[model samples]
Target: MEHEESNRSEFLVFPLSQVRKEGYKVTRKAPPSATDWSRRATRTQRGILDGSLGHYKGKAVPKGGCSAFAAQTLMKGTKPHRIRIEGMSITHDASATPDGIIDTVLSVMRYSTAVKSDSDERVKGVKGKWSSCMRKAGFQYASPQAAANDSRWSKGNVPTRLETSVAVADMQCKKKVRYLDTLVDVQSEYERNAIAEQSATLASLQSDAKVWLSNAKDEVNKQPATKRD
Candidate 1:
């Protein structure tokens, strides 16, 4: 399963920007509720984060959501549609995608384990600063995710005033030390390093995507045309 995902990621041409961007850019700047629950939380907000708005496939899935893979894949698909829609009938113009290619352009694309490692490193670097900031603000949380899951706000209810307070405080501390900005800088630096590390593989993927898109267009053109009046 893991190998397949990495292989898929090689074909995945999406950026973190294209990967279902959250309102919060950096992990540390996120609110406590973001970790306590997801933006796609149930009314109770106890379920897992599945990247859906609780309404899916003609059902009110109060507890259900989409997988991370689906979220990443959908974001890549939507890149081509980032244009103004002028009519009810929408036609696809593939040229809108990155370089008019069918695939996405991943700068420092990594899969399963490498991605986990990168995420862990990013958090580990700034987590201490965040902890110190929280301690100064009269809180003793380890990280934002920990603050969100601190069990005080886990009674099948919405984000209460207490959660809101913590979230606000978290954001304040992060901003004070510029923790979020620093974290992004660090992550981007690592991203550049990783891209250089995997330059050969990334280059091959780019070539593959162009040919893949061209083949897709050829197959579409070969299909029979509909009869018109």
Candidate 2:
């Protein structure tokens, strides 16, 4: 009995005779190894590599991603370098140092100061014009709210208003204090002159008094000669 040939038949498969033939060789790429993955990561961190990449915090997948695909999907929604300060938009780059962050904050502060200066100048001009107009009309310009709350505007209640005024007064006081500090640098010169002038005047008066007392003593010693006779 002839056994039926196995369902699988061996065909006469031959390698292409010429190495230069397009189908002569079929090469399969190997899956990335651990070293390959590490090199890829280094390149990415250095911003040399293109396309999406994964980042992990620890042993498990990161909160955002498990692979390049997941990481790319998450980062697509991310906004980079958006910052704000005191209701104003500020531009900043990603920072790796605390000092860089501080610089960004200072930049925002400088911008705010510039804006405040411009506003104050405009307000000053407007207030000056309003004051002049009110003066010419012989009418005082006062806040109706202040008039309604007499206690809030009264001189007798000044101490109670300290809390409200302290902020502005404190700023003025700080400027004065700085001016005083500058004056203190020259204080020694003034003090030296004062001490020298005072001491010289006092010494001259003492010398004159001593001379007068000596003359008086001599006169007293010579007196009463006629009286003795």
Q: What is the C-alpha lDDT of each candidate?
A: 0.47, 0.35
Per-candidate TM vs. native?
A: 0.49, 0.18
| Predicted candidate 1 versus true structure: per-residue lDDT over 5-79, tens digit per residue | 111222221223322232112222334453634555565333234434665556565333434332333234332
RMSD of 2: 45.8
lDDT for position 168 in model 2: 26
Q: What is candidate 1's TM-score against the reference?
A: 0.49
Model 2 residue runs over 4 Å out of place are 1-45, 48-52, 55-85, 88-96, 122-229
Q: Pick the candidate with the highest lDDT.
A: 1
Give residue 85's error in model 2 in angstroms: 4.9
